[model samples]
Target: MDLRTANMEKNWQLLAGGDRQGLYACFDLFYDDLFRLGVSLYRDVDLVQDAINELFLELWKIRERLGEVRNIQQYVITIYKRVLYKSRHVRQEFASLDECIEMPQSSYEEALIAIQTDERRKALLQQALQQLSERQRQMVQMRYYEGRGFREIAETTGLTERTVYNTLHNALQALRKGMERVE
Candidate 1:
């Protein structure tokens, strides 16, 4: 393993073992990457920073229960995405009353329908994700969620570029088939 990966793994193990410095080390190592990911997903610097802070706090609270993680970045990122998305949803829910009142009834109705449709699509996508094998799911997330190129994925995953491509291709096909079945 490379020095960076080795360092992350060591810190991950230390965090699991109840070392506060390990947690600090991990936060320092991953903060920038996570911040970039958060901003890319939501485009709100404050919200992204808040989400990252919350994520580390939660991790520290649950450190002992985390057990072994094969890939620390991927694991933390998956949790971070959930936290960021949930935060965004909560913010939307508390939007100003005046804003709601200012919208016309027809426009409000259309917005509600659009939101419902989006919810349905999200549910369908979740179901599709569940159908994929663990490896395929990882590849899909790295490629789409983290926006990593195939070569980067291959290097990080220790898979050949061709294998990464094939895995992602098959994953997309499976997702397409699953969505088609639903439609």
Candidate 2:
């Protein structure tokens, strides 16, 4: 009837007919809406993207059986919501150590382990920071330890904002590799 509705029906038919291009077209058309809905429901970008990916994968798997529907958009959204609901329901909440009565000793042990782990992580991070070049290290310290913004760091160091960003990016990559080696 209408252009949007007509397009949806055509795409749905193509999908039902096992046309991969149609599936891609449908993804292109609905991806933004699905992303928005998933984010609103789940509040995690990675989770939302994963859900969308899984949803599309499942749709492709069942494309042949996917019969005609009055509203393709609504149909896809319903599936997305169902997938999210099942994922959300499957999670088991763990009580904090403070909330558990029987594990006080275990809690203390866990706390000690956590503190040691944090110290080791800090030491590794410091080592990684030291591996950075002088200019890169200065940029990182100004941005992170000094709590200065990129613009402020650039102003103080007499570098452009883009240069400051590039320096930080390279520094972070090096730190990541160094930390991985430490791990």
Candidate 3:
């Protein structure tokens, strides 16, 4: 077998054997591919990484099922697609909710209550985040989560500084509106 195939098989076997190191190694090897797949669909590198990280965590939760995976890379890609699918789906679902769910308050108090650390809470946050557009989500992550400066984000993303600031501003505005509605 070619070296790549051999390595894949070996890692598969190790993962099937419940080797933590092997699973981590596999994650490292496939991270770029999975991230790229996420970016291709979502057009936001940061969200891609977040989605991949979430997927990897979910994979470990089902590690015993690894042996059934005939193609590890394909499995990972499928998971990434599912994440993207959910993001898009959630956004669509919320699009129709304005007339159904009561609109959130114009202020932030009730929205802050929506965030909690329980599984259900995290799931709620994930669901809300999924409703965001790709660029909006990325801007939120860079500005609030990563604490990145607008100029740095602009340089990294090839956007003008003004554009970065505007994106971040717009994203937060959208998020606030969404959160108020969903909250």
Global CA lDDT computed for model 1 = 0.86
Q: Alpha carbon lDDT of residue 70, candidate 2?
A: 68
Point to the candidate with the largest TM-score.
1
Alpha-carbon RMSD to native, per candidate: 15.8, 15.4, 16.8
lDDT per residue (tens digit) for residues 62-139 in model 2: 987877566687889999998777665553135455674652233334544665798999999999988999999998
- TM-score: which is higher, 2 or 3? 2
Candidate 2 ranges beyond 4 A from true positions: 90-183
TM agreement with the true structure for every prediction: 0.52, 0.49, 0.47
lDDT of 3 by residue, 1-183 (tens): 787767877886787778887778777878767755665566544455667777767777787888888777778788878876776676557777556565433223222233222455566567777877897788778888999988888888889999888877777676566656765
Candidate 3 segments whose C-alpha is farther than 4 A from its true place? 88-183
Scored by lDDT, the top model is 1
Could you give candidate 1's per-residue lDDT for residues 66-165 as a string of tens digits?
7667778899999999999988888779997667554333333454466578899899999999999999999999999999999999999999999999
Number of the candidate with higher lDDT, 1 or 2: 1
Clashing pairs in 2: none
Model 1 misplacement above 4 A:
97-183
The whole-model C-alpha lDDT of candidate 3 against the native structure comes to 0.71
Better by lDDT, candidate 3 or 2: 2
